[model samples]
Target: MKLVVQVKLLPSPEQAVALEATLHACNRAADRASAAAFESGLFSRNDLQKLVYAELKADFGLGAQPVVRTLKKVVDAYTALRAAIRAGTLGRPGCVRRVKAESKPITFRLDAAQPFDDRILSWQHDASTVSIWTTAGRMKHVPFRGNADQLKTLREHRKGETDLVHRNGKWFLVATCEVPEAEQYEPVDWLGVDRGIVNLATTSDGHNHCGRRLGRYRRWQARKRAELQAKNTRSARRRAKRRTKREQRHATHANHKISKEIVAVAQRTGRGIALERLDGIRDRVRPSRDQRAALSSWPFHQLGEHIAYKAQRAGVPLIEVDAAYTSQMCPRCGHTARHNRPTRDSFSCRRCGLAGPADVVAGVNVRNRARSAWVFVNTPVPQGI
Candidate 1:
């Protein structure tokens, strides 16, 4: 398993200026490479490299590997645009946006994992600082701080190339460390997680993490934004931006707490987690304007991602089951019908007179479906059938 640990960097004023200049230079080189690729219709990494490598080093004063990284940046963007165009998600390759000189994240990729192992990033455990090569031809020592675990990794198991990034008025070093996977354990019991807009998640064991507070916060934000738009003042615009950031931070905190609780529950119960495959439910559903806003603001995907990573870190098995008919089917009697769920929160079965919270019912159904899948995968076909 590859996990990325982000360590915050504390650079001196001069070093900060040098790092910013390096970022701008890298972006300039990326823009030049992108333009050349678009004009010449050559988008391969090798083609871009052949065209811009030497020029980037000579003209932009970038290091050798940074030049390659710049060309790679442009080629990746062009490749993504071409893919989207082919997949019909985008109209044409021209729809791709140009890399901004300062807006895009500025990164300096290390030469290899050897640099990290050799203490190029962490000079030594004694110093607790990094030696970064800059355009000024100077090796700057930038102090960094992180948790004890991250610091231990930097001292011992830090592997692969590191990316030094500047974003949101701070500098960070992102390093990917290879962690060994835990021994696989077949789950004896499964914990079903039903994710939806009304209830963020409901478990088969009768835990409901409703999004009512989050919903109210979003609605308040929407109303506030509307009021600010009506005023149309510069400070109002700035306030709106600040509000957006605050909302994001709040939602992220809530998600962290919710995912932590869900994982703790699963771990304590000695059960594997089962989640629904909700890839494109938003595109499939048609709702009223108010409902649309609520649905669009739902953080189901983010919640699922948090659960997945936490589960993996905790050595718990996590499986995603097909979501089809999970809500309509009755978990108790196997009765399936749209009328089973007449309201957003209420669920009732016509065949067995079973009734419960709609999300809880869905959770139960998800657990059963996951058990079925596990059986199908584990069972072998008999010979001479």
Candidate 2:
């Protein structure tokens, strides 16, 4: 499994200046490369490199590898933009969002993170320092720190490229670690998880991680955002952007906490985890106008990703089952209908009169599906007669 370990960098003032200058130069070169790619329709890495490599190397304050990284970054940005448009998540062909996105070349922030390979960056784990290439020159012996576990992971399993990131007022080096996975054990049973807006997750075991408090927090943030937008002042706009980022961080923190707990419980009990395949959830479900705003921006996908990665790291078996009618179907009598869920949080069977919390019942259905699916996966077919 691939895990990201972030360590805080402590650099001298002179080193910081060189680092910032290098990042700015790289991003400026990337902007120019992106413009050329957009205007000339040369989106491939090779094509873009051939066109802009000499220009960036001569004009920008960057060496050979930095120029190459800048070109590759431009190509990657275009690739992602194309994919998002094709995936229908952005909108249809004639939609305003699609038109706007296609109108201009992708741009990067001046302080955007840049990838560093072994050729340009070297780590000294024993000294807790790194030496990296900079616009001024090669800056050596920049100290860094991290938690005990993070340091251990960095020393033992760090691999591939590292990213030099500047966030808020802190510098961080995000290292990729190739951690070996624990051997997966045979599961006693499946622990089904139901994801939603009101309750972030509800398991078949009757554990619910509610989102009411987070919902209130987000709503308050939204209201402040609206006010800031209405003001239309420079400081107001800046504050709004900061608030938005803070809100995202809070939501992400909540997701991490929830996923860690769920994975720990599943691993401790020697059971597999079951989740719904939420590939196109936004298109599938309909919500009231009042609820639509919350549903649209809900971090359900992030929660699922968190659970998945944590499960992988813990060697817990995980399965994703079809989510259709999970809440509406009666687990006791095998009845399915919309009427079964008269209220958002409650469920009742029309024919069998079996009732339970709607989210828990949905989780139970997911567990049942996973139990059957796992058996089928491991079962072998008899030889043809």
Candidate 3:
């Protein structure tokens, strides 16, 4: 399994300034390339690379090597950004368009391919400090007095992180690591997953996972955002930037946790996962204004992506069945009717007089779908349903 682990980069003041400048230039180059691709009707990576490389060398007079690295990194951003846009995974294009309009003037990408060295620790821990090395020469360290759990996590998982930045002020690191696929165990009789607005997810097999706790943190963030909007002051802006960083960190943590839980459940049961195919969920979810404010704060698509990757790594097939009537279906009698789901939490089948918690019923329906698919496909049944 491919997983990314991101640790902070600690650079000297001079190096930090250079890194910031490089990121700024890279963003501008990316913006220009995106515009050029949209205009020319040739929106491929090769086209983007050509546009960014030419613009960097001719317009900016950067060296060919640096220009090449910058172009490569920008292209990676472009690929991710464009995919989000095409999949309707991001908000409107206004912010990106605005960035393109105001171009920045440095750029960098990795200039040389280097072999992985095991001696280089991804993260290091002393009595009261933790450090992570990005390259052989650059390392970032954070101070924490005493946290054994954190130290253990840092030691075991630090190597998976890679830093990537979009602009000067906006920086992020992608953390991932490869895990060997688990051997197939006893065939699974069933797997059940529950997805909802409040809790995010719970499994019938006694595992619970929260979706995005960032929504809770947003209450504290709202004040900072308001202050920034009112005064347009430097401190307020910095606070706003910090809040955004916190939100991203929270999101990454949530994704890692959810992915880990899902993979664990699949491995333990040796069962195919059953999840609702929540297509067009954003459109369907109708929350009150306050609820919408909280709901929209989380990244559901990112969670789904984590599950997909981890499931693939574990050799666990994840089935995305139609969720149209799962919530209303009577798992005991196979009675599916709209009126049976009169409330969000309660499911009462009128035909069979079978009733249960709405989420549980839905989860059972999902498991049944997976089992039925296996049966139809003539896959060997797992022992003990």
- Which candidate's lDDT is highest? 2
State every prediction's TM-score relative to the real structure: 0.84, 0.92, 0.64
Q: Residues 237-304, candidate 3: write the lDDT tens digits.
A: 88788778877777778777877787777777677787878877778868887777666765666777
Candidate RMSDs in Å, in order, are 4.7, 2.1, 7.6
Instruction: List candidate 2 segments past 4 Å from native.
Output: 94-96, 350-352
Candidate 1 displacement at residue 93 in angstroms:
9.1
- Identify the candidate with maximal TM-score: 2
Candidate 2: which pairs clash? none
Query: If ranked by TM-score, best first, what sequence of candidates would result?
Result: 2, 1, 3
| Model 2 lDDT on a 0 to 1 scale | 0.93
Model 1, 105-185: lDDT tens per residue?
Answer: 323332211112223344445677878766775555678889988878666666777767776678888877777666656
Model 2, backbone clash pairs (residues 3+ apart or across chains), number: 0
